[model samples]
Target chain A: MTYCVAMRVDEGLVFLSDTRTNAGVDHVSAARKMAVFEQPGDRVLVLLAAGNLALTQAVMQLLSEPAPEDKPTLYNVATMAEAARLVGDAVREVHRRDAATLAEFSVDFNCSFILGGQIRGANTRLFMIYSAGNFVESSQVSPYFQIGESKYGKPIIDRVVTPSTPLDEVAKCALVSMDSTLRSNLSVGLPLDLLVYEKDALQVTRFSTIDNDNHYFQMIHRTWGERLRQIFGEIPNPTWADPANVPLRARETVSNVPRVTGSELRAEPDTSAPPFQTLMQPESGQSQH
Target chain B: MTYCVAMRVDEGLVFLSDTRTNAGVDHVSAARKMAVFEQPGDRVLVLLAAGNLALTQAVMQLLSEPAPEDKPTLYNVATMAEAARLVGDAVREVHRRDAATLAEFSVDFNCSFILGGQIRGANTRLFMIYSAGNFVESSQVSPYFQIGESKYGKPIIDRVVTPSTPLDEVAKCALVSMDSTLRSNLSVGLPLDLLVYEKDALQVTRFSTIDNDNHYFQMIHRTWGERLRQIFGEIPNPTWADPANVPLRARETVSNVPRVTGSELRAEPDTSAPPFQTLMQPESGQSQH
Candidate 1:
């Protein structure tokens, strides 16, 4: 499993990836999942991959190979979308060559990638390519893509990031998102690769290989959780009784039933009815009435 | 899909569940997922279900029916573990009745539940039941259980809640977790059911059916994200190319990099190739080096 996220903000693109892989819990190991293609002053394409290690490596290998006469390669693609298509094509190619053999051992042909960056003549663009060789680009309405072990870290990104977000803020949000993922999932661990590319720069402006000792990330990993807990503590607890208490949600109100009494036992009955005792006793024998 | 979570803290138990259900994006609707059974003094059990709606409802119906002989029913169960087994048994019963028929329609026999509360003689307990009619009780190390659409909300809980956490803090954390889930997943929506029980109180003292208008939740939903973004704004941006950068990983002191030239582009290619980019560059030249 892996967690790779890329955001396309007005100022630039932010990409982050973790470095952990496991065939099973006992076979866990570290594997970098980021790849970069640069022609300096021309095009800067960064890819972040997730899923089966073998298949992802194969796709990367194929993309690294010189383009064959009939095949589209990432290096030769004309546009960001073309690069995305080439990535998807590579995934499909891997599927064609390995899916059946892997399936014999019950492994699905699984892998996905986030392809993003600028190509000299065009604007910075982002895409998410799936295991089935399908892809979709980011838009103003949805200016980001996340692959592999994404959900744990998604809510923060959904709330804070947008095409209008500042470059620095987007980078911060990405780190916070990765912090959350690291806390909840063992499959995503440290030594993060973070790349922030300014719009039309066509070269990496900010790139850091953040290990456990990375000061900013360490502060983030520590301070964020503490501050979150502090804020959580500040929020008022639910007012249990008092229907008229009026909470933040104005649409509905709590029912004014007597709070359950620990000592007030439910009805006891003879052999025919059976003696009863429980936390929620019926208010009365109204049903029988 | 639904998001339901339960925690067994030393202070007591906290259970929260969302109401949204959808067969597909266009088929969205709301339905309550939490059910309560209280015999006032002897026991209190709350069942929060997620997964195939019909199957979950069927299991609930079976649990509500007259107790069958030779089976451990929630009504007659002794310990929380036994109670969990009863729920599992009911699940297995439902699977036996509907799984094969559902399979013909290509529907999965998916249904899961988080059952938690007090049974007078036992301590507050929480258990998560799976589709296979197997279950695991929460322990001190991992004091909570979540079912269906869970990952989005998990990181916060992993960061904040523990058996030693106070009841009020747990309640607040649960809402925050639910807020994150709601933000990320449309399948989990409002009209949440929240029940918080105090330890040794065999009764349901605090229960609220919170809708979109609920004030406390609205405050949490609003403040958490806003505060998060604010905190994000305060974290310094990654300073590019600084050897003595405070944000750099403490263990790896890098000295060769030049300071970032603000708004100025350097025309020279990097003289020293960093190993990070070398591994990421898919080109054969970099690979051979």
Candidate 2:
């Protein structure tokens, strides 16, 4: 499993990927998942991959090799869309060659990629290429794409990112998102490859290979969790007994939960059950009443 | 799809479940996923279900009806373990009757449950019942279980929950966890059933069927997201150029990312590329150097 997230905001594009790849819990190794395509004054492209390491490596191998004169490749694609299409084609090509062989072992041909960059004359664009070889580009309403172990880290991104977000701020959000994923999922490990591309730079510029020892990432890993707990503490705990409290009030209209008494097989209305009580103040002797 | 989470702490047990059930995205409706079996001064048990709504409903129906004289039932179970075993046995019975029929339609006999409660003279216990009718009890190390659409809501619980956590705080954590799940998944919807069982209470006490209008839940839904954004803003954004800064720095020992130049098929080491630059200060004009 892997976790890779990329964002395309008005300022530029941000790409981040974890390096851990595992065949099983015991067979784990690190492999860089981000590959940059750059031409100092002409174009810059980045690809972040997740899923079966073998399949992703095969696709990466194909993309790294020179293409035939008649074929499109990441190096010469005229626009970000065409670059994404070439990637999709490469994925399909790999599937055609390996899917049947892998099917014998019952391994699904799973692979996904986040492709984002700018050609010399084109605007910065971002896309998510699926296992099926189809792709979708990011839109104004949805300015980011995440692949693999995504759900644990998604709420933060969904709330913070937008097209107009600043480049550094986007980078911060991606790192924070990765920190959450790393904490919750053991399959996704460090050292990370982070690349922040400023639109129109037309070159590989701001990039870092982050390991556990990186002080800045260490700050994020520690501070984010501490701050989250702090904020969680600050949010007033639900006050069920007091309706006038701003945080929470147990209203009369809400229905009571049904319960089956020990003497009955089916749920029976227990007239003795209270409509509401504060679970927060269990020591007060009022919660169980 | 559904989302249900149950926790066991020193104070007691907490159970929360969303009411949404769907055959598909287009076919969604509300069905209470939580059921309680209570016997004042004797025992109390709560069951939360997720997966294959039809299969879960069948199992629930089986448990609700009177059991044969030779068999155990929720009402007569001698201990919490027996209650869990009866629940597991009920699941197997349902599987025996419906698995083949569901398979004929290519539907799975998939259902899971989180059962927790206490009987007279026994410690409160929690168990997760799988589709196979086998169950595992929660322990000190892992004091909670979540079923269906769980990942989005998992990080918070992983960070905050412990065997010693207070009951109301656990309840708050559960609500926050549910709020995250609800925001990320459409399959888990409004009108949640929340039940908090106090240790040794031996009856139903604190419970609520929370709809969109429930003030406490509304506070959670609104304030969690707002506070998260506030803390996110407080965290300093990454500073790329300064290794001395607290947030991030490019280390010297870390290898540079490989790049494929537009004019080259494979990556080439470009010594010309700058080692470090500030992506955060795009207006500084030093980033492109």
Task: Say which docking band candidate 1 falls in.
Answer: acceptable
DockQ of 2: 0.46
lDDT (Cα, 0-100) at B14 in candidate 2:
93
Residues forming the 10-long window of minimal summed lDDT in candidate 2 chain A: A280-289
lDDT of each candidate versus the true structure: 0.76, 0.82
Model 1 over residues A1-289: C-alpha lDDT tens digits? 8999999988989888998999888988988888887665677789999999999999988877654455555545678989888888889999999999999999888898999989988899999999999998899999989999899888888888888888877888898999998888888887788887889877765677777656667777888888877776776665443332323223332322222221212223212211111111122221210
Best by DockQ: 2
* CAPRI verdict (incorrect, acceptable, medium, high) for model 2: acceptable
All DockQ scores: 0.23, 0.46
lDDT of 1 by residue, B94-178 (tens): 9999999999999999999998888887788888999999988889999999998989889889888877898878888888999
Expressed as tens digits, the lDDT of each residue in A34-126 for candidate 2 is: 998776777888999999999998999888876667677787678899989889999999999999999999999999999999998779999
Q: Interface RMSD (C-alpha) of each candidate?
A: 10.5, 5.0
Model 2 over residues B1-289: C-alpha lDDT tens digits? 8999999999999999999988789989988899888767778889999998888889988888765666678877888888888889989999999899889999888899999999989999999999999999999999999999999999899888899888888989999999999999999998888888889888766776777666678788888999888888888787665322434434444647566543445355445654444333333322323
